[model samples]
Target chain A: GQQVMQIPQYQHVQEGEDFTTYCNSSTTLSNIQWYKQRPGGHPVFLIQLVKSGEVKKQKRLTFQFGEAKKNSSLHITATQTTDVGTYFCAGYTGKLIFGQGTTLQVKP
Target chain B: EAGVTQSPTHLIKTRGQQVTLRCSPISGHTSVYWYQQALGLGLQFLLWYDEGEERNRGNFPPRFSGRQFPNYSSELNVNALELEDSALYLCASSDGTSDVKNIQYFGAGTRLSVL
Candidate 1:
């Protein structure tokens, strides 16, 4: 059985600060996906990292996959109040296994 | 383009009752997956249906079962529900195969409350 763990179960940051959440998997992942869930909304796909040691960016959000493909990280620069939500990393096997999300709260 | 859609946004049932949750995948998508998310917990894989066949399932009891329809729509049925079954059920779909990487589009979950 594979297990994915996320760090910083919760985070409170002032607006304009940077935030990073890490995810580690007990087994090697074929690929990894990142999702964002706003309060009261369903999970939304943010990005997918396939190649090992891959790095992708979406405006202010950056996603990276470890060289071993056993971990991933999502970094948000200059966090905004609108960025308040939970970030989840899902590792792919025959199916996707989601990590316990990191809840981020940005203060104005 | 239509995203994943689920029926009965919220449902309430009692222990030992049966509940059915429905999900419609995105157009032309062949892979559908079901997951359960208890409050404050991560998403747990429930079942994977592709091409109208049960491809994979997680470590859940057989009480949790589902089917894929001809149109690629799916239904999750929880029999003899328990208070522990109270959680949100989510459905997702992708155009790729079950293994490896594929972008999954999710549906707004069905909140199941068992008393």
Candidate 2:
């Protein structure tokens, strides 16, 4: 059974601060996907990483996949109130094994 | 290109009652996945349906069951619901055309409140 473990269950950051969340999987993964769920909203796909050591950036957000494909990280720069949400890392095999997620609270 | 769609934005049920949730995948998508997100908890995998077949399920009890339709839609049935069943049930879909990587597109989940 594959499981994804996320670090820092909750985080409160001041505006303009940086935030980072890490995810580690119990088994090797074929790909890793990141999602964000805003309050009262569904989980929205952010990005997907398939190659080992792959790095992708979206504006102030950066995503990285471990060389082993068993870990991933999401980093947000210059946090804003609009960035408030729970970030999830899902490992994809035939199905998805989602991490517990890291809830980010940005303080204005 | 429509995203995944789920029915009944919210639902209310009582103990010993039964509930059904419906989900329609995006056009051309053939895989549907159901997940339960309890308050302050993570998304717990409920079931996976591909090509109108029950492909896999999670650690949930037998009371939690579902089936896929011929058109790639899905219905999740929960029998003898308990108070702990109160959670947000999310339905996601992916293109099952030998892509190998499952990049899921989620729908606005149905919030089920079991009393």
Candidate 1 TM-score for chain A: 0.99
Stretches > 4 Å off in candidate 2: B97-101
Write the residue-wise lDDT of candidate 1 on A41-95 in tens digits: 8889998898899999999999999999999999999999999999999998766
| DockQ per candidate, 2 decimals | 0.67, 0.66
lDDT of 2 by residue, B11-75 (tens): 99999999999999999899999999998788999999999888899999999999999999999
DockQ of 2: 0.66
Per-candidate TM-scores read: 0.94, 0.97
lDDT of 2 by residue, A5-86 (tens): 9999999999999999999999888889999999888899999999999999999999999999999999999999999999
Kindly state the fnat score of candidate 2: 0.66
Total backbone clashes of model 2?
Answer: 0
Q: Which sections of candidate 1 miss by over 4 Å?
A: B98-101
lDDT of 1 by residue, B1-115 (tens): 9999999899999999999999999999999999998887777889999999999998999999999999999999999999999999999999986455377899999999999
| Native interface contact recovery, all models | 0.75, 0.66
